[model samples]
Target: MSKKLIAIASTGGHYVQLSRIMKQANFDSNDILYVRTKVNANDTPSFENESLIEDVSRDTLIRSPIIAFQMLKLILKHKPKWIITTGAMPGLISIVIGRLLLRKTMWVDSIANTKQLSASGRIAKKIAHKTLTQWPDLVGENVQYKGRVI
Candidate 1:
């Protein structure tokens, strides 16, 4: 059977937050496919079912389409029942595609965003089924505070 969930995030803080959430959520690693950015040689597989895609951001708008296509293919290939992410551009892209495919989607704003939601998190508030912030003060009608991941 296809994986039950797709959990994605970019490198650094985003990936760290995703990892902590995964552990706390107590999901079976075998049932989730982890998607993260291809940062450097130091990056190694953290889970048996995982894939890495090129990292792109607002500064690299020209390549966003490529990242989106990659996410689409990844999502289609896995056919996950749900998609959850800790944000950066990659995770936001995955949520969008996951939603279009009718997959349940959730976005957790990085804990690094203490004062406000990140750009991707803001947009995700509109696209994802649930948008969460680590800071309770940042919560709004579209976003919920789920406590800190760090």
Candidate 2:
């Protein structure tokens, strides 16, 4: 069987960043899967389209549990060798689920977060196999500042 790579991204900027990495990584389409919202899915030809909790802000906290469950299901079903994200809620949850399954998880905090880590990135620091930031100043022991998608 082919090694599977699961790339998760939310709408807008998150999608742009993840898509850029996906394009550069050049993994075969058959070995790649995307966990994204309907808004962006119309453009990327994904292998699966399960409903994950949508992009959320501080006020939309109630959706976290649902997103967690959905991510758990996806991870168990696909068992990807690597799980990557340009992130927010869903990405963080997938990292948690993916890690629980002993899968490698990477998170590239959205370019939007400059001074501080985004909500998901903060949580990712404890769990993800690797966490990347777009801004150099934000680099730390566990968090890294890798070049951005561009």
| Tens-digit lDDT track of model 1 for 1-150 | 489999899988888889899999999888889889988857777657878888889889788888899989888888999999998898988888898999999999988888889999889999999999989899997999868888
Runs of candidate 2 exceeding 4 Å displacement: 1-3, 40-55
**Cα lDDT listed for each candidate:** 0.89, 0.79
Screening candidate 2 with a backbone cut-off below 3 angstroms (N, C-alpha, C), the clashing residue pairs are none
lDDT for each residue of candidate 2 in 100-149, tens digit (9 for 90 to 100): 88999999998889889997799998899999999999999799876888
Residue 56 miss distance in model 2 (angstroms): 4.0
Please give the distance, in angstroms, between residue 68's alpha carbon in candidate 1 and its true position after superposition.
1.3
Candidate 1 wrongly placed segments (more than 4 Å): 41-46
Error of 2 at 46 (Å): 6.6
lDDT of 2 at 9: 81
Query: Who wins the lDDT comparison?
Result: 1
